[model samples]
Target: MKKATMTKMHPRCNEHGHTVPIKQPSKASLAQAWADPQGIATAVPDSAMPETINDVPVSAWQGAPTDAAGWEALVAGLSFTEPPVPSAPGKKPAAGVVTIEPDGRVWVVAPTNAFGGYRHTFPKGKLDGLSPRASAIKEAFEESGLQVELTGYLCDSVRSTSVTRYYTARRIGGSPAAMGWESQVVMLVPISELRGITSHPNDAPILKALPAKAIVIYEWGLASGHRVLDTLAGHFTRYGEWPTRIAIPTGMHEGLREEILSPYGWRLLTERLKVVATDAGALCAYGARGQEHSYDTNGPVDLRKRASEWIWNVDLT
Candidate 1:
């Protein structure tokens, strides 16, 4: 067939004495190879593979590495590694608690080695490997000499889940003589007088997170019919970005089955969601205006809602 002649690859992909079919080149194909830095045309000098200017080698696209390790290595060689931080930081070993009494009073424990003067403020303490509540109980007993039960979710503060549950525990047992390392004295005061008390740097965080919830709940009830029996989360409106919430009802969202979610700016929000499990199965329902939503750290509870999309997360157990 007076076909067009061709030049050899010089070194075939096979190590020795082997020849594969000679492939023809196309104009559109040639444009792509010329655009690639790793393509055969770029590797060969002008003296060789003159025809490669016309097409990508079949090998160029074939038998690509089955794994990413090779690509990762190539990227590593071309990229710079950021130097590590010179100073390694330490993480706090455990969590602490602040228990206030029912008469709006908290027994502040004084630190044993006060940096400058005698220090005293609510019964606060740290948790070991045991449950947080259990540790709080032990510390309160040891520090303030009082045994009690934890009642409510006071607030969540800090970046690393330093969630301290403030309990309104009745003094079930013990006395004021008990003490621990860095802890010596304990006394009580009304919640209305919380801010007036002297505080340590760490104490400030707990106080800030302390919920003025009694008032917020009262306001929610006055404004809307939804009487907030408890607050599951807090909302602030300092900036102008009003948060939009979409109620996610648990079922299963089938593999991003629709493109509509993005256009609507759908986001999974933790603030207003409630997880409800029942005889039927586990379901996720979010707070609706008609339905009450609370994020009390006591955790979200599914009360009820209307006209909200109820989808399921199949991975949910």
Candidate 2:
């Protein structure tokens, strides 16, 4: 030690060529460490909760303890309602048209040589490089061989591939016989007969929304009388509207029922509800066929009451 004196190493390199020692990093507080790791939490510590709680003195809760721990415990015990979540992503749009005659007959299409033509549906198609309105117009032409002008947006319904947007339209030209290959037969069906004839349940709402005169024909003797009413009422309430006609017992009134069932009535009643009487003579005389159905009256009174609610709400001007 006397022969050679050693100097302490400096933190920084010296001009004299002495070795420099590496400096160690300072340790941070637990909170600071947590904050540093998480980019969100702040390193700045919050003061501990107040020893005394600033209680809101209401008549019902005035006598509650004001200790901070007790207040925290109370708050912990309280429940909160979660916010509502947004609707799921919407399905792609399928544009289509709903054509209705002045007499409340809706145009529908039957698939040719398919399923024995047992199912009838509205003329609608997927949007293929056309605007919604344009697509609807095109679909009407292609499926029903009819030219139409869109009147208004009717409603939205779900399909196998996407959601369908239906637009109300009036026929301007074209013949149903010339319908495209997609449809075997295209024709006008009465609004009241729609739900029964249409294979797709979704189309019922469109029919219900159409304006039409209702005929309620019933017979006390028929076991299906009440059932028919119940089914019709269910269809009406579900679709937000009522049928064009209903059949009740003949004895409910004295005069000839056929006398009141006029052409204007037939245009309105020309086609009886498929759920009602299936007399071939009556259907043919009215220029239609007997309805094929299986629906029976479940609760005629309750169903009628619900249908009445919708009827009362309708704007019948």
Candidate 3:
């Protein structure tokens, strides 16, 4: 049998019998050394390593000291601070809530000291020992001073190091004046406008997912009212754009026509209207013909009739 050529590995110690691996500069030590001009002396030169090993320098290693105290001092001089940010092992789970009110307004609070310049967001906090739903409700009350009932689940997300569960809630009682120290002020904003005020972009989608319903004032006898409403619903179904509030004359007349046509292009002169008319005669003519035409049953005619006998509310919101 042919004798095999054996490659000899270098021993842990150098020719001077000094420990080699023990003196290697840690990442923190290397960073500190780079900051100090004298650290260039301690850094291993690229030429120190053999030409075979990817031409990479054995940068971290250094010659060990002779005296025991000197070795201890060199080891002490090394640092380990440059590791990744440490997270607490086995951190507890957390929960938060998105609270809404009965009037299509959502509850949000401004923290006393906001993060990333975010002043307005839905109430959220760490979960204690309670269930996620219970914790969410508790957080809502504690942060906004409102007692809320958990309606349904909103979403769950990993925020920072904690996995937080979110729930949808509705205010039942209490007032913003009773808010605890955690929040500066509690605000109730219309759901449509919630995204504009909230500083956190992540919270905007939750507010957007809520149903969009408008309170439109329309007289049952007016064919123009039905025409406008049916067209609006069709537009929403096709494009997913909806109006949160709509206003129409309780009964059309010369005054109403003048108001609608007042430099606003008859108000319905926009793309939403099938036909644009400036005067009452033209508007009434459209309405008279509108009654004879067939419309989609899926469109909200019955819903509109059910909500009919409408009162004139001064405030559309």
Whole-model lDDT, candidate 3?
0.44
Question: Tens digits of per-residue lDDT for model 2 on 1-317?
Answer: 56964533322233365544312111213333221211111111111121211121111112332343432342243222222222225666677777765444567776543433446777776665555666777777666666666655666676445777777776666555455555555545656566766766666566665442222211122333234445555545444445554444334212223432222333332243322344331211111232221233222334644433343333222
The order by descending lDDT is 2, 3, 1
- TM-score each candidate: 0.36, 0.40, 0.41
Per TM-score, the best of the predicted structures is: 3
lDDT for position 14 in model 3? 38
Ranking of predictions according to TM-score:
3, 2, 1
**Model 1 regions lying over 4 Å from their true place:** 1-89, 115-118, 124-126, 156-168, 211-225, 228-317
Q: Which stretches in model 2 have alpha-carbon errors above 4 Å?
A: 1-90, 115-118, 211-317
Better of 1 and 3 by TM-score: 3
- The predicted structure with the larger lDDT, 1 or 3, is 3
lDDT of 1 by residue, 197-225 (tens): 64555456566644332112111123111
The lDDT values for all models are: 0.34, 0.46, 0.44
